[model samples]
Target: MVAEKITQCMKPHGEEGYQTIENMNENHKEISDFAFECVNVGENDKILDIGCGGGVNIEKFLKLTSGNVDGLDYSGVSVNASIRQNQNAVESGRCNVIQADVSDMPIDDESYDLVSAFETIYFWPDIANTFKEVSRIIKPQGQFMIAQGTDGNHPDDELWLSTVEGMSVYTADELEKYLLNAGFKSVKSFKKENDYILIVIAKK
Candidate 1:
């Protein structure tokens, strides 16, 4: 029951899911901040944030860029929450959020300069296919950033892995291998302190 509840919150479904996403936004601030610091966002670059929960990152991305930012999530609840959170940007046409899965995103080819996935890839059904989709939407030399609180080597990850169905934390090296297999030309990873928090930067 505990695992089921956690999984539901991770993907979120209804009113309760909205609250969970809000909680996640508050809790994930540190990793997100660290991830952004590891890269530079061009003033006029289109960005797509995958698995965008509560639209917090999307809001931040809007402030960081003069160009547009888009968000995609598999959960309708998350989609609604992100829309509500970034209503002003959406109204002004600077941001757009959609309900969709990562493996088959409904975005145009080479449409974005950067793509981000934060604390969400663990739930993707097929990481490889999803990476391919992410690659498709990115322009030449575009970057894909993945930020996670767990680097797959954390001692606590075993507990979460046992409890959470379909949750698979990965090491920076493992992610780098997959990213390269998906057509990314180069990949680099960063660590925050001694914690399991890892940020991967992949260029296509």
Candidate 2:
């Protein structure tokens, strides 16, 4: 059912789980660098972080932007944890966290300068629908970036990797094709860690 297993795996284990993920280097470096490349945030920009999970990326983006950043996750537990973790940023109105699915965010069209999804799209049952939602919320020429863990380099793709129930690993070309089909322009991709992870940057 669309890999609801992801929600289960990330159901939250207090700060320890979030802390572990934040501290681990198994697959974050590339995704982090990709963030810097894609958004290239400015003082006046507004951004969105879809499937924000533990809100680490929102926290990172806050350091890069003087503008507002909004985070949305399908899991209420995740949203609460993210809020708790990024409370100061939220209180300062520089960041926000909400519980919502990737395919139906409670945001308006043409609302953001950038949209990012970090290691989360694989769980979406309808990747195209998810992109459609993301496209609707970004302004013209705005950027959309997807950061995913590399299945090949995940260190567990053979035994423990989690993926959409019946879907196979998506090649960079396949991902780009879908994004283009979804109406994204200027699509480009970057591979990290020997093809273990891929970052796709596209414009709306």
Candidate 3:
């Protein structure tokens, strides 16, 4: 049911026929790139990436920073695929990939300088609990960021949101409210085309 639930939202046609990466590149890359560009990775900052997928984005950080980088995803396929794609980073100890559910990450509290979730949160079964866990794993003044589509952005938005109960195009105000409620000090967002994607920078 867990796989079914999440995959249903990702699949444009059916779960088995879904090619998330391929579909995304066609219509959602601009939004994804926009959010990804906000990372602002300074030297010596520890970074954590939730739902690392195939590690294309994680590789960007690994190449940009000399500091430690880690990623977690619920899908074993995704984690392994990422590991294979970024084997250099893994071999150099600059990056690591783990299989974990967002709501129950294996990382310790205050462990990272930045945490990012790219196209990942809408599938979360409990956003509050996941936010709490992500917040707990960052240091003071550490940040948590998410890259997501806004209303009327991605062509599949309506179907995706419909199949997944809590899935949404989070407004900046709504994101701020939720992040603040989850103990983040601040939250802000931006727009890409019709998509109102959030690049939340929440300080602990």
Candidate 4:
């Protein structure tokens, strides 16, 4: 029951789950900052943040780029929270939050210059197929950045793997293969020294 509760909070579906994500954003500021540094966002790059919880990263991306930033989450609760958090940006026509699943995104093809997935791929339905979907939505030469706290080789992840049902931790090599097979032109991975943090960047 405890493990199930944890998973539910991670994928947030309702009011309580929305509160959980709000709290998570508060405590995960450092991890989010680390992930942000790995991506190279341009001044005019339109970006989409996949699984953007509470819209914190969307706010951050706004500061990083002068371009529009969009947030997509599978959870309606999360979508509402993200809109609330980024209300000013949305009102200014700078940001948009939508309830969307990664495997089946409701977005136009070749629309964005950058797509970022931060610590959210574990719950993705089909990792490979989702990568293809991400590729389809990105413009040619667009970049996809995936940031996770685990490198799949971390000793601590064994506990998360065992406890979190339907969660899968992927290694850099595994992710590289999936990205390449999904039609990415190049893939590169980076890790924080002495830490399990892994950030993989792929070009379409």
- TM-scores, one per candidate: 0.96, 0.81, 0.82, 0.94
Give a tens-digit lDDT track for model 2, residues 15-56.
655644444323576676765665567677788887776677
By lDDT, is 1 or 4 better?
Answer: 1
- Kindly report the root-mean-square deviation of model 2 from the true structure over all alpha carbons: 4.0
- Cα error, candidate 1, residue 89 (Å): 0.5
**Which runs in model 2 stand beyond 4 Å of their true positions?**
1-7, 10-30, 37-39, 151-168, 193-195
Q: TM-score winner among the candidates?
A: 1
- Candidate 1 worst ten-residue window by lDDT: 1-10
In candidate 3, position 93 carries an lDDT of 84
lDDT accuracy of residue 149 in candidate 4: 84
Indicate the TM-score of model 1: 0.96
Q: What is the C-alpha RMSD of each candidate to the true structure, in Å?
A: 1.5, 4.0, 4.1, 1.7
lDDT minimum window of 10 residues, candidate 3: 8-17
What global local distance difference test value does model 4 have?
A: 0.88
Of the candidates numbered 1 and 3, which has the greater TM-score value? 1
**Cα deviation of 147, candidate 1, in Å:** 0.2
Tally clashes: model 3: 2
lDDT of 3 by residue, 105-150 (tens): 7787789998888776776766767688888898988888877765
TM-score of 3: 0.82
Candidate 4 lDDT trough over 10 residues, lowest sum: 1-10
**Model 2 pairs whose backbones collide:** 150-196, 150-197
